[model samples]
Target: MKQAQIICPVCEIKISTLELPQGKNAHCPRCDTQLYRGSHKPLRDNLFLALTGLLFLIPCLFFPFVTIRLFNINFSANLVSGSYALMKESSVILGFIVLFCSVLTPLIVFGTVITAHWGLTRQHFTIFKYSLLIFQRLKHWMMLDVFLLGIAIAFFKLSEYATITPKMGLACIFLTQIVTIFLLSRLSVSRYWQRWQSSEQFQFDDVQTHCHHCHLSQPESQSCVRCGFIIHKRKPNSIQKTWAFLITAAILILPANLLYISIFYSNGKRYEDTIFSGVISFVKSGMPEIAFIIFVASIAVPIAKIIGLIYILIGIQFKHVTDYTRRMKIYLFVKWIGKWSILDLYVIAITIALVDRDQILDFLPGPAAIAFAGVVILTMLAAESLDPRLIWDDSASNTPQKESLHEK
Candidate 1:
């Protein structure tokens, strides 16, 4: 293979490609950010995997995800019903967000992946372009893995009260998650571009500018020639938008954790649980493991995200450019863990769907669910609004006058 020129999205360090064995990625020498990893699998294999995952995921909505049995009462819940149940319990916004994150995003991503591969197979670059772009933009929002974890936590928490059994839908979703994650891990933007170039002369290698959305290097233009997403040196209005989101999230985090998040009724006795109280309940019930998970997801992650984001923002504002590696790690960690914070919402959605207003046992969404949802969403938006490249840019120069958010 011939050497190719590539620019690191983080530091803009132009690097010459080197031949590396399969399964290893080339990293930026300056910031250690991954720059390239060639996918070994053919597009056909990815197409088949995506199709398999979609087929499994579709049936998951119709079939029972889990069954609950308690004294003349039996009920089942699946993805669709869980969202509906959440909406009926007055947490409509949170319910819709959960539905979007778990169901719609994954479906679109997989569908796009298959179509993109189909386009590539047919040499239809137009179809390939749009589908691949959509896949790139939406893949991060897919939370099937977190949804699966929520399933386990819900089962453990509810087992103390009722007989809970996994159903075929659960099995299907599990397989879907595994397949999707594996496919995503193997999927890399550069591999497709290389494949395209091999078929014909392509301009990808000549350009040094990188698309953050797709991570594809192309000739500098208003939009990415490959993915069609708008291109920029760094995310537009990165710092200002991040601070706005973080401040809003910081305000909501307090109410989100302190107020009641869920209500349960068992044989005419009403019980309510806040984020902390719920975790404590799990510990009291001899499930400290589950308690810890809940604490981390529902309580710790949200706060940590806010504080971490604030730390990054303050560092940038003060031009604290030292510890580039530490700041970069904080940025990536915040982004990676932000979505997992929504795990509790899924648990609540599933539990309320399965046991909501059942006379024998029931669950209801409390006021805090919405607040908590806001906390999660805002923090995620905050993380996304931040440009990781900003850390490197700050390290290179502390020039405050260039590229001001106010300058247009």
Candidate 2:
């Protein structure tokens, strides 16, 4: 069976998304933008994978995750312990962020995906329609992978001062993270959307109105039947909203780097670490790899995201815009890498969770931690708010090439 899509999501060019070689993907012949991936697996496999990931998350939440023994005082912590500790210390917002990003968010992503695939298998199109939309938007919020990486970083940082042992919950979390990633790879919106599309016969005005959620074309001024999103040629006020978020993040990022990021009281003496000092310490201790990662995520990513966004915005608005492909690539990269900046917060949360606070030593999130977290969140929001399609729209230098399937 040959399934087809009406228009290219990136360039908004009217094209056919059919007849790709197995194991290869269909890229837009004009701009080299990938349209959809070819999948040999059935929708049932996706359903099972989503269900398996959800099953693993159960043990990951409650079972003992790590045990740390410092000075003969043994303390155990689970996945939720970080949130509890933060809440007890009066960081209500940070507490909720950790708990929701680690647990509730993943649950929503996995549960919605399971429902969507299940609905597809049972021919209950209505169920999958809305469920799929929910999964698409919230899928990136599943920071379970980043949280697990935090555990590894915490283990390395604490191993010198304490005896750290991985427990059953760690294994469950690893499996859940891997399974969730695989499930996402297979759950292609365009592939599923093609199945729901009744006919390949193109309708007038359909090619002009493209739905970002479903990646399908429909008439103007109407709701997308598959996803129920109100059709807009481009996201409404994308540039203005994105600029507001970017400006706020840019302003906060300076203080976030300059101020102490983490603070602890050891034997009644205060020790504070700034972002640069922490990176320098890591390098001084011969863990340059970890140092580099922190520097990139904490420092480089935010700056790059802001610059990339600014360049794209300026490129689109200029009278003579060139290198549309380059602009689109930048946009995609910025959007994809924005979430990794939260890794720093995860490290702090898990590190604090591992050490039980006492008279001898107490850990607290420094004022800078909140500022840095704001930058991460605001950059993510900024990326999501901008419509990449705007880079190609209304550009005189570039025109849509003839319709063809260029396999990649």
Best by TM-score: 2
Candidate 2 has a TM-score of 0.93
Tell me the deviation in Å of residue 105 in model 1: 1.3
Q: What does candidate 1's lDDT look like per residue over 215-276, in tens digits?
A: 66667789876556788877889999998998888898888888999888898888989999
Alpha-carbon RMSD of each model: 5.2, 2.2
Candidate 2 lDDT over residue span 191-298, tens digit each:
676676643544453345667777766665578765677887778999999999999999999989999988877777788999889899889988998899889988
Model 2 steric clash pairs: none
